[model samples]
Target: MFLSMSFRLRTEVEALNMVEAMGAYSRHRTVSLLKPRGDGKGYRLVIAPAVSGQAIAFGYMKSLVELAQQKNLPICDQCRNYESKGGFVKHGTDTSGDLENLVRSCIVEDVTGFMIAKAEVRRTSAIQFSYMTPDIDSSDVAIDPQFHVRAAKPGEKPQPFQVESGTAIYVLGVALDIDKIGVVPDSNGKPKIVVANRAERVKTAIQAIAHLLEGLSFGAKKARYLPVYDVVGAVAAISHPVPFMVSPARISKDMDYVTKTVLRASNYVKLFSDAKETIKLFYMDKENVVGEVKAENIDITKADNVSELVLKIIEVIEKSLRD
Candidate 1:
């Protein structure tokens, strides 16, 4: 069943900036915000749906492949620094091509130029996220001035460092086609089984997404802080494709209403499936987390079970993670 997941991300000081121009006058420093649809200016946080989907795919694949890429170390297996330690393997699939195959199928290889050529586009990413708009009206937003001191070397002079901070309840609605991807037995019997099925593929992709998004930091000064998501998603009782993006206004915070809206919307589109929303919270750090986001929150780290939930939500469509 195709399922839609939508939720509010209440972020604090998520430092996002797409700089068009720069100057030494810190007060004049500009940060991008979501402009209305017809406006010409682009916003970094309120991203385009297509780009968001690709970014999701990239995030997911990057999470899945990082270990192998790190251990494999060098690009071009021919590099002299490369020793044939036979350690460049993920889950026993030691070959680089195998890893590349999985990555290219779902994500873009823009992580690096070498990965770009190798990671040719395969199955288009099924996850579609809408332009994440703030739940509250833009006029209600309050921007606070952040002040800092520029650390200068002996040869340089100091300057003022100021940035504006804004907080909003942003909403993102995503539709995932879980019925399309599944895991089937490997033709070559390597790595035990293949994750190419639509159900399995979607599961893997979502898991990757959950991993990437957890403790995600973006824009400038990424090290300072991260965004937190009060996430919710619904799975259908049957295979109903949520192909369209519903705006935040039309969405209901109530879980039942959310499910019904999805059902009705799908029916109108002549698509049929049942789904329900499961609620959870996601955060960045595992320790000292002084913020309000709880540690008990799901999908906290790479080690979390967030990935398995994808399969759980699609149990009506496919029961097995590996088949």
Candidate 2:
């Protein structure tokens, strides 16, 4: 099973992710992209603040470690200590030279993947994250430097610094291959399940995703500048036998992205009509930001919040596992 999701986040006065501090100014990560001009003539370049995929992935891994520990799943010493700066685990020394031992012994390594530089053995991660960036179609995106100062003594000068803060409707996309957890490819390049409790591991993986989004757990600088954020809207797609990516919410502000993604998924499903390929969609529209969505052929589930939506998806996954 392959799961893809896209969500809209509204953050105000947030310095969630930042680059190196240059002098007294701390810079927020920004990217330049070409956007269609309102005149319908040409495209213009827009520089927008963004949160890196690395940052988001790190946060997700942290949540994964916590959930795995709660279930008494094995985690390497390095990952348990939250070492290597980004929740990276050390490669296990498998004396038998079989990489399967490495994955079977540690849930973190199995899900996030790792590379043995000396041996040149690498495992691709089952989960993927896209950079959290402002919606290109929205006109309310803005980033500016906020000035701050440290407390001064009776006769001492104040220490002042600048940090970039942003306000925008940001979009984030994530994908996970549920079948890959606790499974490794064999020497013949065929998938092999190395762990015995595959269902438990898969459910934990899904739960970690819920913990990450619902808790708003990703990003940095929460000690001082915690961004006021809300999940404005979201859409998720689940497919079997073939990978299907949902359309991102950043495409346009005028159209409902949820309906658009369902239509696209419906078309994709028809391509494999003779096969067992199937897709299911779920969406949540808070504050009526997405308005009404219109589609047919497939049923779309609606949830009142993020937790409820994830629970519905988990039910489908559990049923698939039983089959």
Candidate 3:
């Protein structure tokens, strides 16, 4: 099974992901993209603050650690400690020459994948994350620096610093290959199910995603710069045998992302007639942000919140596994 998700995150005064610190100034990650001009004549470059995919993946792995513990699944010591300095997992040297043992020992490594330099072995992660960036089609994105001074002791000079904060309707896209969890390709490139409890691991992976979004868990510097955010809207799709991605949400003149995704998926389903019965789409439109949409060949269910949307999808996935 393949699962794809896209959601709009509205964060204000957030220093979620930071890059290198120049002197006393901490920089927030930013990216430049070409957007259509208002005059419809040409495209203009826009620089917007962003949260890196690595940072987001770390947050998801944290959730995976916690959930795996609760479900009594396998996890490595390095991941259990929630290490963030060098990398999320222990270095590949620790698990050299044995892909089965590496996956068998840690659920995070199995799902997120790892590379062993000395052994020349690499396992591609089953889950993928796109940078949390502002929607190119929207104009309601801005990032600014906030200045602060460290408190001074008696007769001591105060230290000043600057940190960048961003507020925008950010877009996040995530994809997970459910069939890859607890399964690894062997020496001869044949896929093998390494873990005995593959189904539970798959469910745990899905729940971890729900946990990440429900708690708004991804980001940094929450102690002082907690963001005021909301899941304005989202769309998710599940398809078997063939992968399908829903259109990402955007705040353009016409906010019909949900409709567009459904139409696109409908066309895809028609083209792949065998997958028509196995494909499903779910969406949540808070405050009626996404107006009515009409499509065919697939059913679009409206969920109350992130949890409900994920739960409904989980049901479908679980059923597919049984078949």
Candidate 4:
């Protein structure tokens, strides 16, 4: 007679070996972690993705402690020496606020049915869903050859600078233009972040710079503004609604694209502005404009609201007496 016998693994034995066999067992585990599935004696715990090791250990300890307490088992000795033994003690142990740590017991079941057979362990804080859109546009941006403000070395067609919709552009080197809201120049010379929305302010600052560049190019030196305006026209001509729609994941990508485009545009404008400033400084012998050009004086106070941002660009120009 040939007889095959199976040995049922004890809960204590399994707990003892959990740390040792984790690597080997994790490979076969399907990771279908769910709510605790058993009672005091025997229960199944489902492991979920993104669940940290600490959390799992806590879950395991909690169920085990509950079972021990039900059986009237003594946990004091283990609880007392936990700090030295590298074990955890649950809260309400001594009420010293040092017991937030969890206590878990090792448990295993055999194929044979036992009391409270096929029980389950319970847990909380499962997967979460996000309502707002993600901010990265994965398709529109690439990792290679970082976008540059200046043209790529000769023979390269300027790479398409695509951006996601709802992406905002900002002005570079224009932080200095912010009006201090009735404050004279402070000793430190650094702009403060009181009521102004820093990020939106950056965008407004860039617009100010753009208007400043326009005024510099057209007013003092006529030809300097022409090249840059032509560049702007070229960009606008090819401009197409970002190749894709907006989503949370794609928003970030689109933001980067838009940022790069805005930066490049601002840089081009700066190049022309700087060239004119230099030409005026050296050949024309003219002083730098002081919030000078009527167009460059962006009323940050007036642009404090949404209606101002959307409709006031035209109002700004129409209101200007020089134009």
Candidate 5:
């Protein structure tokens, strides 16, 4: 069974990945839209699944180490030997390599790993996520204008240039699958446990996703704030394996669709309690978090008390686990 997570996204002037300058007419160069296909044309609406997955993985690994220390777990001195003159542990094992290093048998990089085998490179990733699909009216997308000022050198005035900025409102649907991925075969060709301490590793990752996204800026400029508003999720289990995608047209503040999705997921969980994975839908609206939902879960109560994004995410994750 494949566990899935669906979510929403709203961005403002956050150039995630920059494309080549469209036309360097003005001094300030313009970044293409999310798609960035041609000189000025590709009306990209969604954040690529690859980019989002990398971001999530990076944050998850980073937070895993920090959280481990907070919990008083013994961290390897070699792993923490980050300040040595050795260039990125030139005299040490790659800390980023999940299998090569260890934190109480927990891979710092979690389920993602790299190995060189018989002159052939092998890589593995357990958690997978999909591109965030947007729900905006295509006609509503238009090229907008923004200004950038070059730093003045010596006696030169700060050159001001006009770069084309894109303004878009999209409703995104994202999917996540947390199943165990490929395993490495050991001597005699038996699958060894390449992924160590999975439950703890995954828990840390989920915590990072919930708390770190707002504080850590993704995609483009960090100087300018990229707005992330009202992010939430609908997590549950699944019965029959089926590909699910939400229409972009339903990306409004309305919770009707979201409610139905949650109910469906709940039904699926009830029907398929023995299934290996669950279903998750992450929507970016608070209006849907209604009706005794929080009242039913104590973890959610704590989340509500703190109003932290991480807690809110935990609420959804815990709900999914229970289902």
Candidate 6:
């Protein structure tokens, strides 16, 4: 039930609030907010969640889409390129349900890479940027759950290690992996389980959630909550700093509905930013560069499997880190 609500709220009311909240989140997080693209048909809000930018972006966008739908606002078009029309946009030409025609228009535009970047381009929305470091005093750092310990055991089902050390330790150079699985043995010899990706899935999830967290914080004007696992992910630590980016856009046709759009956008950003930030603060080094992205052009046709490609990227990152 809680899970359902989480997903629903994220896709509805919370989404509307994102537009109004963007400036505050950016200012407080101490991260960077890239210039919003206002050129072409719509606006492009891009963000880089040093920790989980991608997941964060997804969460924010998903929620915003729902909110706009409920309010009779133009549905948001998820485009791979800000300047390209790969998604749909609404035009007043259709007599279908106001939202329905809007959706159709968007679909048509998306196919051609011509989207209304901003619903009303005459007005410009202002966004803020913020970045904050953990209260660590040293260059070398490691972050573990205040309650998590033990290298993940191998298997389909995994159990948390009896943490001999009560406090989660922070370490540098250990990378977080999301969507990974680990198994522990039961008394009968059956392995209990925990699963995520080996490494890439972990990173992708991490980036996704981090951007969400930052968005939430920027909007709520207070600390936001997230699942603890998201904070740690598969990465145990980093020796470099990763850049985080947050960008919010209305999923609606007019972009006039700031409440739902902003809310959803902020939530998504905060989810990703918090997890990413926590990992960076708890585990990564000052020198390590964290990568945050507000927007990217995703070519679904170009990849055989989006999920597989993401994981493969993880393999590459892992290999690079190990070297």
* Top candidate by lDDT: 3
Candidate models: Cα lDDT each: 0.38, 0.83, 0.84, 0.23, 0.41, 0.26
TM-score of 4: 0.16
TM-score of 2: 0.92
lDDT of 5 by residue, 216-296 (tens): 433344455344444443332222344343323243344444555555555555555655324444433453444343211
User: Candidate 4's C-alpha lDDT?
Assistant: 0.23
Best by TM-score: 3
Which sections of candidate 6 miss by over 4 Å? 1-50, 76-104, 107-142, 146-158, 161-323
Task: Give the lDDT of residue 108 in candidate 2.
Answer: 78
TM-score of each prediction: 0.51, 0.92, 0.93, 0.16, 0.56, 0.20
Residue 222's lDDT within candidate 1 is 46
lDDT of 2 by residue, 1-323 (tens): 99999988888888878898456789989988678898888999999988999988888888988898898998877788875544564553332334688788888788888877666677889999999988878646888999999798899999898999888888899999998998887789899999999888888888888888778678889898888988878899889888889888764645678868877888888888777678889998885756565556556799988888889999999888988
Q: Provide the lowest-lDDT 10-residue window in model 1.
A: 294-303
lDDT of 6 by residue, 1-323 (tens): 00000110111111111222322122112123333344645543333212223223333334334333444433344322222543222332233333223323332121112223344211111111122111121221222222323354576444342111011111111122221112223458674432222232223333332334323422221222231211211111121223222112112233311233223334444555634422111111122222231222110111122233334444444664356
Reference-based TM-score, model 6:
0.20
Q: Put down candidate 1 lDDT per residue, 170-274, tens digits, no spaces.
A: 555566554433322256744232333334344444554455545342133445534344433322122233344332422322333233444445444443223
lDDT of 3 by residue, 249-307 (tens): 87567557897888888888888886544568999888576778767668778898888
lDDT of 2 at 32: 86
For residues 1-323, what per-residue lDDT tens digits would candidate 4 score against the true structure? 00000100001001110122322122111133223223535544533112123433333333333443554433445433444756543222332321111111211110000122122211121111111111121211111211223357788765443211111111111112113211122248563333222233222322332333333211111221121221111001011111111111111312432223334433343555634321000000011111211122111212222223323432332233123
Cα RMSD (Å) per model?
10.8, 2.4, 2.0, 31.0, 7.9, 26.2
